[model samples]
Target: MLGDMTASTTPATSARLRTEIPGPASRALQERRAATVAAGVSSVLPVYVTSASGGLLTDADGNTLIDLGSGIAVTNVGHAAPAVVDRVREQAERFAHTCFMVTPYEGYVAVCEALAELTPGDFAKRSALFNSGAEAVENAVKIARVATGRQAVVVFDHAYHGRTNLTMALTARSVPYKHGFGPFAPEVYRVPGSYPYRDGLTGEQAAAAALDRVDKQVGGDSVAAVVIEPIQGEGGFVEPAPGFLPALSRWCSEQGAVFVADEVQTGFCRTGDWFASEHEDVVPDLVATAKGIAGGLPLAAVTGRADLLDAVPPGGLGGTYGGNPIACAAALGAIETLRTRDLAAAARRIGETALPRLRALADETGIIGDVRGRGAMLAAEFVRPGTDEPDPDVTRRVAAACHQAGVVVLTCGTHGNVVRLLPPLVLPDDLLDEGLSVLDRAVRAEAGR
Candidate 1:
C-alpha cells in the first residue's frame, strides 16, 4: 500500500500473483515500452515487477518470482526495507531536494563520515557525493589528475566503468555501452587485469606484465591514477589473484601513482565486507562506491586519503544533486541497518552456503566454465565443453528457463555468458534455496546432461 493511489502502489514486499509472468498487464506494459522507449534500452529478461520483498519480486501479472538478481545488485538490503522506506518517506515529506552544496545537512555529513570510517586505510579521509556510479568514478579520476598533477589515466582490459562518454572510453565492451558513442576523451589507457582464469599469470607476474604495458604504452610517470574494480563486475565477476591488489598498491606507491578502487558493485556488504579491498592487504588511495550505498537510492561517493582528496581546489568536484538530502537520509538508514542487523556477516554466511552448491552444479554441468566471486557477489561463467569459448546460447536458455520457473536472474561478462547471482542477504533461506534449485535444473537442462 502507498499514499499515492495510482502507480507503484502495492504491498511493499508481498508478491501477489494473479497471472503468468508477462500476463496480460505486463505484456501490455512491454508493448508500450517498445513503442515509446528506445530500443537501445533493452532488458536481460522481459519482466515487469510490481513489488518486491526480501527475496521475491511480484510481477505485473501477480506472480511471485524469486529475486536472485537484486535489481542488478542495487537492493543489497532487499526491496523496501523498513529502515530505508522510513528514511525516504520522512525525507520526502520534510524536504526531498535542497541540494547539499546550497543547504548543508546532517545526513550528508553523516554518510561522508561513514565512508571515511568504513573505507580501508587508517589515514584521514574525506568524501564527495555524486548521483551515480559513473559520476563517482569521473570525480575520482578528476581528483587523481588534480592531486597528482598528471594527465594519463590508466584502466584495465575487460573493465566496465559506465555509459558516459568518458567512462565509455574507460569501458572495454563495444556493442551495447559504447556502440554509437564515439570521439571519447583522450589520455585514458588500458592494461591487463590479473585474470587468472584466462591469463594463467601469477599475481606478481600479472602486475609486472601490466606495468610493462604502462612503461611501453602509457608510461608510469605520465599516469595520474590507475583505476580498478576490486572484483571485475561487468567484465566478469573475476577475482584477482591473492597478491594482485597488494602488489599493484605497492607499485602505485613506488611510482607515485594514485590507486583508485571502483567498488561500485562490490561495496556495502555485497561482498561480505564493507570494502572488497579489505580482503587483500591493499588499501586504495581512492575508493568509489555507489550501487548499494543508499539502499537503492541513486547515491554515490568518492572517499580517499585526506591529503589527496584535498588537493582539488574548492568547487573542483561536486554535482547539483550530488548529495541529495533524501539520498543521504536513505544512506544513513542503510548504514544503520547494516550495523544493527549484521548484514555483512549474513552475506558471508550466505556465500559459504551458496558457493558449494554452485560449484557442485558446475561439476555436474561442464557447461559451467568457472564459478568465482566473494560472498553473495557471485557468478557462474558458461563455456562450451572441450574449449574456453563462451556459450552464450546455453546461457540465454538457462536464464530463460529461470524466468519461466519464477526466478529472476541476470547475465554479465565481456561475452555475455556469465550468470550473476545477486540475492539479497536478507532473503529467506527457503526462497534462496528455491532459486538455486531452479538454477540447477536450468543449468542441467541447458547443458543437456
Candidate 2:
C-alpha cells in the first residue's frame, strides 16, 4: 500500500539533493517559523519537510533525504502509509470525535481489544487510551498507585518517560526535559539502570545493585510502580543487560509493586518484537505504549493486567480525546498492517542489516565506544578516542555530515553522544545500506578529524 502511494511523491530508488541540506526555501521557512514557533520546540534538521513517504523526506527545496530517523520512531509503517491514510480518511468522513467518555464508540473498544490481545500477557488484560505517551504514562502511574495503595514511584537512570510534571519527575534527564520545571510530583525515586558499555556488569549484578538501592532508599514495599523502558529511548537507546528486566520484574512482584514497561518508543515493531519486554520474556504488569501504535497519529494506551487497571473506579480513568475516532481508525489500520506485513520480522531483518554494519563501524572507528540496540532501533555511542568519555561534539559533527550528505540521522543519550538510527521497517535494503554507508563515512571523517 505504501509502495503504491509513495512512488509518486518520493524518489523511487535513492536520495536526491537539489540544494544544500536546508536549501533556500527551507531557510526562508525557518526564518518565518522563528517569528511564530515556540523557541523550546527544536528540530534536529534545519530543512523544512514538504512531504514524506516510505523512507524519504522531501523538503521545501525538493531535497530528498534518506530517513534514518523515522520521526523519532513514529513512522515504523512509513509516513503517509496507505493503510493509515485510507482508514483516517474513511473515519474522518464518517466522524472525527464524539468524546469516548460521553458517547462510547466501537473503534475505542476495538483498539482496547487489540491491545489486550497483542500486548505481552496471556492473562486477562485491560487498556485505557490517551492522547499522548505522557498521558498514557501518567495514567499508568495513577493506576499503579491506586491499585497498590502505595505512594512511591521508582524509575531508573538514563530513563525518559515524558514531559508531564509527573513524568518529568520520572524522567532522569534534567537539562531540557526537566530543567527549571520543579517542584515535580512527590514519591518519585531514581535508581541505577544497567548500562553494559559503561558499567560492564552482568545482568544479575546490575539488577542486584538497583534492587539494593531501592530497598535502602525507597523501601521496596512503598513503591507503587517501577517504570522503565525495555530499550531506553531518550536516555541513549540503552538496552538493559539480558537478565536485568526479568530480575527487576521478579523483585517488583515480590514487593507487590507494579512492573511497568514504558514501551512508548520500543513498542509496536520498532525493536523487532511486538513489545521489547517480549525479547526477554518479561510480562510487565503495566505497559505504556505510543509513538508507533497509531501509525504516526496522536494516540497512546496503558495496557496491563486487568486487576490493576480495574482497580480504578468508573470515570476515574479517561480523557476527552483519548480515543478519538479518527486516531482509533488509524490504529486499527496500522495494527493490521503490522500483522499482515509481519513488520516485527521486518524489524529483525533491519537489525540484521544495520547492527553488523554499526558494529563493524565501531570496530573501524575508535570514536564509536559502543554499538547496541534491538532491531531497527539502533544507536552508536560516540566517545573520545582511546577513552570511554562521551564525545558529543564528534557526535554532532557526524550527524551534521550525514545531514549534509542527504541522510537524516539523530543524536541522543544523557551525555548527548549517541547517534541513533530509526529507519522505517519498509525501507529497502539498498536505501538502508546507502544510508549506513553515509553514516560510515561521517563517523570515519569525524574519527580522522
Candidate 3:
C-alpha cells in the first residue's frame, strides 16, 4: 500500500498552493529525513501528500498539487481508482497474503493467463510474477541466460533498469542508482541507445551501430539477451527509432540472443498500447512488466515465449512474496478496468491533446530542445537557448516553479534536464488544461529570470 492509506476518497476539486514549494509539512519531513532517514534514500521535492485521486495530490497541509508525474507513472489508471479499490477491498477481506509459491491461487494464475494473451508475439507465451520492476527485470535476465546458455547480458546507454544488484549492473546511471554500490552483477554490457535527438542516428542506423558494437565487443554469439526499455522511463521519455526495435529483434534472432523488453514503465496502456513493443509490431523473447500492471499495487511480471521461459527448470525463478494473492486480485481488477474503459485508446487521446501543445511550446521556447514520447507517457527535454546542450538547472527551476504554482512536476534524463509529464489518462480536460497552463507559466517565468 505504498501510496494507499494516505489517499483521499474524494478528488480535490480546487488545487491550492500554499507556503511555497516545500511548505511547512514538507519542510518538517525533510528535516526528519535528514536526521532519521538514511542518506541513501532522498527525495527531489519533499512534499508530504495526505491524499490523491484522479490527477491531484493533497498535501498534508491541505494543498492540492496537480500530479503530472502520476507517482512515477504508477497510477496510470489514476490514484485510488474505484475499480482497483474495490478489488483490493474484496481481496483483502477474502485473502491477502498466502504466497503464490507456497499455495497457488486463481488470482495468480488469472493474471499470468491474461499476460500470456496480451503480450506481443502470437506464439505460445508463459509468465512469472515478481514484486517490483527490478525483480521482474532480474528474473527476466535469469530466464534469458538459462534459455540461451550464455552469460553476457547487453543493456543500453542512458538506461535505468532498477536498483537491485543485478539490475544495477544492467542500469547505466552511476550517481544516484549506482554511485556507492559496487561489485555489481558480472557479464553485463552497455551499448549506445538510438537517441535521435543527441546521437543524430536514425532508428535503422542506430540499431546497426549498436549491433556492430555488440559484434565487436560481445561477439553477439556470447550474448544471452539484449534488454531494452521499449520506451525508456528514467532515461528520459525516449522512444526507440521506428526501425530500431525491429532491427534489434532481427539481430537478436540471427545471433541467437534473447530479446527482453523492459516494459515496466511503458506497459498497461501508458504508451497507448498494451505495451510499446506493439507500436513497431516487434515482439521480444521476454517482456518485463510492472508499474501500471496492478492499478497501483506492487506487482511485476515476466511474460515470454513458452519454450524459452520453460527452459528454466522447475522451481528455478521465484520469490517468497512474489505474486501475493492481494496483488494478483488487484492486477485482475486493473486488467478489467483497462479493457472496459479502453484506457489504451484513452492514453492515445491524451497524447493527441498534449503533443500539439508541448510541441507548440517547443517552437515558442528555445529552451525546449525536444518533445518525445508515446501516448500519456510524455516528456519535454529542456536545453540552453538555441543549443541542444541540456540545462538541468533550468529544469529544476521550472519544476520548482510548477510546485509553487500548485503543480507537481518530475524531471528526468541522463543530464537530468527532461521534465517528464505522465498525467493520468482519466484526467478531465479542464484539469489537464489547467495543469498545462501552470507548466506554461512556470517555464515562461523561469526562462524570463
The top-ranked prediction according to TM-score is 2
Q: Please give, for residues 28-92, the per-residue lDDT of candidate 2 as tens digits.
A: 99999999999999999989888889898888887788999988998999888899999999999
Residue 131 lDDT (model 3): 95
**Tens digits of lDDT, candidate 3, 1-449:** 11122435554564565456667888887887789888877676788988788888877766787788887888888888888889889989998888777888898899989999999988998999999999999999999899999999999999999999999999888988898899899999899988888988889999989888889988988999999999888998888778999999999999899999999999999989989999999999999999999878899999989998899998998898889888888888888888988999999988998899989988887789999998998899999998999999999999887777787789999899999988887877877888888898887876677
* Each prediction's TM-score versus the true structure: 0.95, 0.97, 0.96
Question: Root-mean-square deviation of each candidate, in angstroms?
Answer: 3.8, 2.9, 3.5
Cα lDDT over the full model 1: 0.86
Stretches of candidate 2 off by over 4 Å are: 1-12
Instruction: Please report, as a residue range, the 10-residue window in candidate 3 with the lowest summed lDDT.
Output: 1-10
Q: Which 10 residues in a row give candidate 1 its minimum summed lDDT?
A: 1-10
Better of 2 and 3 by TM-score: 2
1 or 2, greater by TM-score: 2
CA-lDDT, candidates in order: 0.86, 0.92, 0.87
Ranking by lDDT: 2, 3, 1
TM-score of structure candidate 2: 0.97
